[model samples]
Target: MMELDPAATFRQEAADLLDSLETVLLDLGQTPADRDLIDAAFRALHTIKGSGAMFGFDRVAAFTHDFETAFDLIRKGKIDANHDIVTVSLSARDYIRALIEAPDATDPIIGEAIVEELQRLIGRGDAKGAAGAAAPPAAAAGASLASGQGGWRITLAFEEQILRNGANPLALLDDLRELGPCTVLPDLARLPALADLDPESCLIGWTVTLAADCPREAIEDVFMFVRDEMRLAIAPLAEGVPDVRPGFTLDMAEAAAEPAAPRPEALSAETASHPLPGKAAPAPAGAELNRRAEDKGSTVRVQAERLDELMDRVGELVIAQARLSQLAHSGTDLAIKAIAEEIERLASGLRDSTMGVRMVPMGSLFGRFRRLVHDLSRDLGKPVDFVTVGEDTEMDKTMIERLADPLVHLIRNAIDHGIESREARASTSKSATGRIELSARYVGAQVLVTVQDDGAGLDTARIRAKAEEQGLVQPGATLSEQEIHQFLFHPGFSTARTISALSGRGVGMDVVKRTIEAMRGAIDLTTIPGHGSSVTLRLPLTLAIIDGLLIRVGEGRYIIPLSAVEECIELTAADEARSRGRSFLSVRGELVPFLRLRELFDAQGAADPHQKVIVTAIGGTRIGLVVDQIIGSHQTVIKSLSKLHADVTMFSGATILGDGTAALILDVAQLVSLGQGRADDRTPEAA
Candidate 1:
């Protein structure tokens, strides 16, 4: 029921177009001669330009016009999409995004410079001249036979709702005129009466006799933004040309007067809705209109903030349902219990549905990195082949967004420090082009995103020397490889001999670790002596709502994320006495380290004789948590801890219980870490 902001809508849509433009440019860098990529790039640019102009983003429109002109030449095979051209185009795309997103802060000089560089790459000194030169090659000879001159007859009839979708027919007309001479005539046959007119709707169509010696493709490009939402026909200008004016078969007045039904279209030569201009017309005009209608009705673009607010409401509903269930169980009201049960079912369904809506495929996030990798490869003079796998895997939108910066840091470190230089690699019998592969897949209820680089692996001796030199560890301390790797994540920890623009101010990896842990995720690192290194980030699919196992350590209740719990077992008297001096428990012939929540929280109670162990697996290690009681499963809506308790590592967050009491959510990673430390204390080497 809320109206969308037109400017905000344009900015969002332009962002998507710019992303596509970047991707196309990157692809063109590989296959410079691919006509399809060239045309696709041009179409993306054209749409951005048209939509930007429609939305009063004048700077964006003007800047993209120059960019669109340069790509038009590539589409026509006049210019090759070489590395230089692709690089400049990518910069141009960024500038246009800046112009749309932050026009006040964007420098016009930078935009002009990008355009000049693009033109220079394409062998054109004048941007305007290059655009003007895109006319049909036949125009150089003479006029065509149709109109006794080189010209075409074009008719355009847009849907009545076109204006509402932020398209302007006048802009198309203006674009057409820029090619050559034009005589525009309005078709008033379908015009409604003045009293019956809807100011927001467009009914009048246009017939233009264009006298420019241009290709049909050039004219079709003018309507790139509205091809699917309109009826259009183009033919050589000649006497008795097939009248395609039947586009206005569905009058606005009649459509509003009658019962709503699918809009109709009339078949005419060259009259049909195509995905893009100049593509083969796949369906009749009527069928195309119906298809467009179906497509439009299939999706709704809701704002992200709205989705977040909906999720908040769903969370609240879940908490209230929990309270109602508690009351229903306590009281002996059969009718109230039935109602509570029904509400619980509805609430569960709503939570799942809302969470599903927030689940976005990881491909969208991964695609942006292609451009980043491209730029880094060029900047570092490293011909690296960046590969991504499991792009179809979906994750929470919030998690994906927060993961961006961390992943960026990881990848930058991989290329700057992990990947060997071309010359360095040749001496070691390695491939000339280094490889960095990023992959994601499901591991139980968690998603594992790994960034692996096949280069000289981390120098373990160097890391230890640096750690000992900095007094982080004892001079004669015995440590595991995993423990030595942990030193890399210490603040201001770096083993690089020298600093460069890419890395080595002793930053990046530490921040990556902190950020991942902040999201209730764990980071794992593994390296071979000379093969490669991989960092896998284990993260929950959604952070908003999770299935949790409620437990009581003392008087205080705590919720452990159900996803991380492997199993719960009883701590018998014999087992407790055997491990009295240590926190290790034997589970199925494996010595699993355990942590006592009672001692950790300093709970005020006598130790329970029959405590339980909740086994959890984190980063391929099992850690057991000892608790007094195991409550049943509960749907947990995680709430962030306040700044007052932000430094507490044991608890990740808090959630509301059925009795409206707040219970802290256990931070499994921190507990696993503590258990590991405890296990180290019990080692003979430490002794």
Candidate 2:
């Protein structure tokens, strides 16, 4: 029987709480007068303090106690919530995160320095929230009409894996008791026999009736980290709420005794599938979404590894369905074909559902950047007005996690190098404050995220000169502005005269480019010299699976992401021969560059007499891919290549076909880059 470490749970919770703190501080940084934001920041710090104490993180508790008290002073109007105060607060928040992350390794000197800095910012005696101090706003205005202590009933049933997730139900219980007088009754019916018991799994539930003056959110904060890993409900302890006394209090001696069965308000009526003992009737077929929303508070947190496992199973099922479809097509029986079609449809729906589960809002990732912008603007002596749009746009959670580092680098570079200095902005007649906009939107099957900076755009001449100096480009070589900008992504590429802590290290932009491309995404830059620069990243909504156009290129078969495919056209041998020196096809008054995968891969077979050109668009540029046969569309379950084929950028990944043969999924973005020479030789493609 392995007991879960409570310290680990506190660390995870601290991480989440710190994120919340950062968000609130960023909000306050923007609107210091917003009392709601002030309160939010206070609450986040309070949670970290209390929960940290419960799990034996005394250092964290002590640090946050002061931090919370400072915010408490702000809440009471004893101290002003100005920009300098917020700046110091944000720094203290980062220090607390460090303490929580590495309790022993963290330098206490740093924490003390931050505390002193905060005190100095708010003045000597203004940072305290002592009892003799001024009363809070609610009580200050003589609106202190006291009411009966609210009696609330809360039911919490933790998932079995809660213990393994580093959560401490006992610590959560401790947090609840500290809120007010409370009675906790354990539900141990789920406890298995000794032989069958898994010590790492949580088998206990609790029904607590608490009488407290704190807000309901404070009570919910007990299980903040485990909120999505448990079933919890809070309703007023009204009449008929079983086993809930009007004002429950626990005697020290009888605290361990089991209380009677107590339940909250009847599961909201919408929770048709109740977790507790109460019977719930099923809803109609169309009520799933409503029911889901109702049960939003009762989510079971799943491990990322578990989602990956399920994805693997779904991929297998899709592969089996593909085989079934092939078998059905070879047979004459209509019923078999129909069954195959039904399975295909089911597999498609399942894939969508799985992907949706993995799709989290982009704002979850973007929120952290607000603080980055705030800090960079201040440090660089530049004023920045940060804005975001389409934040509700969602993408694969995995992609979001991997995208954060690259985005941080890109953003830092933008602020450090792309944006001009304050004096320079004034000289240009632009506003003293520059603006940076981060936006995400869905375009067809891809998500377009743009990081646009209203700063001095790319200095193409400087970039070209740097390239020439580094021997990266031929001497006296002429390069387009776009090509010169592309050189910034080359390894160890930089035009900065001096290196600093942030940019000029010649590491970030290249890493950003590599990261985006590694996700089978494209990065494009558009800049107006002196006006600003905007970098747009086009990425697939999901990486696990895709609808791909299966094609044969000579002896090899490959896949073109169907989202990139516009339409297909016949490229007769006559046209190929007549257009010998040409590398493009004229269609509808547009010159579209085309690539031959057979030539690209050097596959051993002759080109078909009438080869097919699949028109594809990436980063708004339409290109044609020449292949032999257009087999059809497929639900491609992407299986990444082995380390042996790691350098093969042309193929994003390989997937198992219906015939059990492997076909590589084409990296259209990379292919487009590969065909850049053709674009240079022929008429440029419309971007």
Q: Specify the highest-TM-score model's number.
A: 1
Q: Model 1 compared with the native: what TM-score?
A: 0.87
Q: Which residue segments of model 2 deviate by more than 4 Å?
A: 1-5, 125-298, 333-335, 475-478, 620-622, 678-687
Candidate 2: 10-residue stretch with minimal lDDT:
278-287
Extract clashing residue pairs from model 1: 143-150, 144-149, 144-150
Please report, in order, the local distance difference test score of every candidate based on alpha carbons: 0.81, 0.77
After superposition on all C-alphas, the RMSD of every candidate to the true structure, in Å, is 6.2, 8.5
- Candidate 2: residue pairs that collide: none
Model 2 lDDT per residue over 1-687, tens place: 866466765676567667877888888887898999987787678777766775678898888877786886777567778888888888888888888787789999998988888878767645453543655687756422221146677766666765654457887788788768998888786778999999988877788888875555556556554544566656556532332222222222222333333332332332344323321321221122224466566454577999989989999999999999999999999999999999999998998899888889999988989988998888899899989999899998889988998889878878998889989998999999999999999988889899999899988888988999998889777677777888989999988889998878788888998899888888889999898999889898888998999999878888888988899999876657545656677766677778877877788857787789898877666788888899998889999899999887888898999978889899988888767667875754333
- Tell me model 1's lDDT, rounded to 2 decimals: 0.81
Candidate 1 lDDT by residue in tens digits, 544-595 = 9999999998899999999889999999987877677677788887888898
